[model samples]
Each structure stands twice: as structure tokens, then as C-alpha cells.
Target: MANGKSLMTGLLVGGVIGGLATILTAPSSGRDLRTQLKQNKQKLESILIQLKDDSISLKESVVKTAQESAVVLKDVTADLQKSIQTWQEEIEPHKAELQKEISQIEEKIKELEQTLNK
Candidate 1:
């Protein structure tokens, strides 16, 4: 954005400076100088109009790209969340099985200790 502004400023300032330099350096009659200035002014106006149109088009393109990126980001986030949930669901049965095995091992240890005491 700053680059665009700088480019526009540079073009405007350069055009003005070039026009002044030409007008000052040229050995033209007063009437001819005035005609030349008018022509230069018209050309500058045309350039500015074209630049304005280009800038508007660039802004619209940026907006569209940003909107599309946001939608894609949203979809990706949702998919990641779903994947995580599915992984957790798949692990739940194994987790329960492990817990049950641990409980059985603890009970056998207690029974062995009791028989040792007898």
C-alpha cells in the first residue's frame, strides 16, 4: 500500500518537474509556451485518470484475494478439529482396555500377597 502511494507521488511530482523544466528551457514565444503548457496539462490529467483506475482495480483484487483466503482458512481449521475428534474417539476403547488390564494385574498382586501371608 505504501509502495503504491509512493509510486503515485513519484509520478505526479516527476510530471510536474519535467513540465516546468521543459517550459523554462524552451525558447518559444509566449503564445507557443502557453499552448505547450495546455497540452502538457491535458496529458498529465489523462495519466492521473489512468492511474486512478488502475489503483481501484488493484484494491478490488486485494479484497477478493483476502476474502478467499479467509474462507480457505476457516475450512482448514474445521477439518483439523474434526480429525482431532475422530482420533480421540478411536483411542477411547484402547484406553479403556488398558485401564481394565491394569485393574486385573493389581487384583492378582493382592491375591498373591494374601497367599504369601497364609
Candidate 2:
């Protein structure tokens, strides 16, 4: 990104230097040359102002996107935690029932083993 900015700056400077050189060599009257140079200066200033406004707009857009992304990420994280909590709540009662069933099965197995021994 820094390299791109430097390249653009170099191009603008080179263009200005070339334009000045061309104007100096042209066989126009002194007054006309001065007028043309003044016009060129105004145009360059306008381009620079527009470039600055564009940069500011781009910066604002990036910041807004980052902020929105952060909000979405936080919302997703909270929803996931809530879903986990709900699952735990729903499963706890069934877990106790399953434990009770296992204990009953173990007792039945012990009774069968004693009868077989007899």
C-alpha cells in the first residue's frame, strides 16, 4: 500500500515537471504562457483535493466495516453460549433417568447370578 502511494506521488510529480517543461518551450506570448501555467496550477490543486477526500472516505468505510464485523462476532458468540446452556438444561433430567435404569440393570444381573449358583 505504501508502495502504491509512493508510485502515485512520483507519477504526479513527474507529470507536473513535464508539463512545466513543455510550457516553457512553447512559442507562445509571455502573457498566454502565464495564463496557461495558472490554469494548470488550479487543475492540479483540484485533483489533490479530490484525492484527499477519496482517501478519507476509504478510511471511514474500512473502520465502519471493522466495527460491524466485531458486533456480529459478539452476537454469534453469545448465541452459541445460550444454545449450549439450553441443551444442558434439556438433558439433565434424562441423564438422571438413564443412571437409574443402569442401576436397576446391575441389580437384576446380581439376582440372576445368585439363582444360577443355587
Q: Which structure among the candidates has the greatest TM-score?
A: 1
TM-score for each of the candidates: 0.70, 0.61
**Model 2 lDDT per residue over 1-118, tens place:** 6975997699698878988797878999989888988988898889888888988899899999999999999999999999999999999999999999999999999999999999
Q: Taking the tens digit of each residue's C-alpha lDDT, what string does model 1 give over 4-64?
A: 8899899889988998899889999999999999998999999899989998998899999
Name model 1 segments beyond 4 Å from true.
93-118
Deviation in Å, model 1, residue 64 alpha carbon? 1.9
Count of residue pairs whose backbone atoms collide, per candidate: 0, 0
lDDT of each: 0.95, 0.91
List candidate 2 stretches off by more than 4 Å: 1-4, 82-118
Candidate 2 global CA lDDT score: 0.91
